[model samples]
Target: MDFTYSEEQQMLADSLRRFIDTEYTFEARRKSARQGESLDRGVWNKLAEMGVLGLTVPADFGGFGEGAASQLVVQRELGRGLVLEPVTPSGVMAAAVLSAHGSDAQKQEWLPAIASGERIVTLAYLEPTTRYRPESARASAERSGDGYVISGTKSVVWHGAAADAYLLTARVSGSNEIALFLVPRDSKGLGVTAYPTIDGLRAADLSLQNVAVPASALVGQPADGLAALGVGLEHGIAALCAEGAGAMEKLIQITGEYLGTRQQFGKPLASFQALQHRMADMLVQKELALSMAYVAAQALDETDPAARRRMLSAAKVTVARAGRFVGQQAVQLHGGMGMTDELSVGDYFKRLTMLDQLLGDSDYHLQRFGEVMEA
Candidate 1:
């Protein structure tokens, strides 16, 4: 596959890097985290101004229509900066779903707001009882006049508290039909409990007790809800793979710099052959993960669902393995300072760890990849 990024994509990468250097420095990130703030609305607005939020939105909704490679670039930069914004679950995946499945009126009403950063949206697809089953919606939706009464809780909703609305998943009553509903955050009987996550970001436990929305809230065909959910999860896996690769890259750079500057036995650790070999291993792992990211990007929107799933699982497992190797080596190379909050090394490792569990982990995807290949 050709790896040609448009000149504009490169410019976007450069621009994001500049912003990171000027605004998302270690001090700023640490201050926000220490202050118990899960997200910086200021940075969120800045990203919107930079057009990062609109990259995946459709052109008719005042967006750039950027996808795959462009999103990979943007997400990688977000990883490098340890950005706390929910751009993946909220921006990329959400925009992809809405653009592909939302009605024209729905698109017109919400997409523009999302594009302008006037509203934040997130996907609520998980339930406490379901494990990676996009279609296994235990939450029941009772049919009301034309719409449905949503009653269920979505666990571990990423940045749910900050969202203006959610694309909620539930099983329609008296049938096996699954559906995605667009529920506003201020809807009656809806509640959110926010908390910090292991990655120094935010997530919330969402409860929906008979939350009512109009029939127009339904996203895509009811039976095809699983298909839409699959697409969203695929984008999620791709994004997480790239983000893991980005964090791995930063970890390698930080480890190498630490080895060069930190003295060991009256000489720089960089001069030690043993440490040098470890750093080389880290670089190899990072590069391997990066190659998998591009491969995942290539297969992101493959028309065949089975083919896309196989390819994404393949890339996800590979990235998870490489990320673990890179993360562990990075922390080990830095010794005591590696896990401390004062150093960014620990935070990067934590983020990498969290990324592994997003969508699916190496063990989970490895089994799926093997099964798909055999099929």
Candidate 2:
């Protein structure tokens, strides 16, 4: 199979790359990060104008992409800049959930806002007890007259504090089935504690006590919601894989540059045969991760759910391992300066570390991959 990007895909990638280069300078990013919002609305709006925020939204709702291919391309670009925006969560994850499970009216209302970057939406799936899967969720939604009352806390909601709305995951009353609801951020009995993540992005701890929503807030069927959640996660992992690839590439670039500039023992560090071997290994890992990212993106369109999960798990494992190796080598090569926050090398290292923890780590997915193979 040909691995080259289509003209449209290449165009989208080039457009995004140029935007990152010209607008997302390290200093600008450093400033925004210091202010506590890893993402600026102005930047997000520009991304929206570029049609990147709606890459996965259904065309009926004003989105354009070929499966997950285009998204992978955009994600790679965003990753290169260590972008703070919650693009994958809001645009890819939320959009995937809405398109796959929402009512037509719901779609009409939310998709346009998201596409235009007029509103931000985030998915709150993991509870403190939740481990990538919602199996440990203690969050519950009890049925009421024409409505449901949500009562539980969600931990580490991606961009939750800044989002206009949250797609909450709850266990339906008296059943093991999963239920999803769209809760407005200003809803009564809702609270949030926003904090900076290790990677400079913001995440929130959400508190919900008797927060109520109309039955119309329900997304898809209770039984089917869990399945849809899986699909959303698969899309998220694909985006993460691509982003991880881009970050890995950047780490390789930065390390290579650092070695060239930093002199050691009366000669350039790049001249050391040992370090040269290390840099070569970093490049190989990055390329391997990129190839797996490509596979994960394409696998999203697979007809069989089992097959899709297997591929995503495998790719996640590959990306995680490669990411860890690249991050460590990058930091080690840079020495003490690499660990300092002032430099981008350490920041990239932090992002890579967090990426491993998010959406399940390498060991978690490796086990999942084994489970799939067993079945």
Best by lDDT: 2
Backbone clashes, each candidate: 0, 0
Q: Give the per-residue lDDT digits (tens) of candidate 2, residues 154-259.
A: 9989888889999888998999988888888999999999999888889999999999999888888777767767777889999999999999998788888889
What is the per-residue lDDT of model 1 for residues 262-339, given as tens digits with 9 covering 90 to 100?
997899999999988988888988899999898899898688877888889988988888888888898889999886
TM-score, model 1 to reference: 0.97
Instruction: List TM-scores for all candidates, in order.
Output: 0.97, 0.97
Q: Which ten residues in a row have the lowest lDDT in candidate 1?
A: 30-39
Per-model root-mean-square deviation over C-alphas: 1.2, 1.3
Q: What TM-score, to 2 decimals, does candidate 2 have?
A: 0.97
Screening candidate 2 with a backbone cut-off below 3 angstroms (N, C-alpha, C), the clashing residue pairs are: none
Residue 308 lDDT, candidate 2, scale 0-100: 90
Per-residue lDDT for 221 in model 1?
78
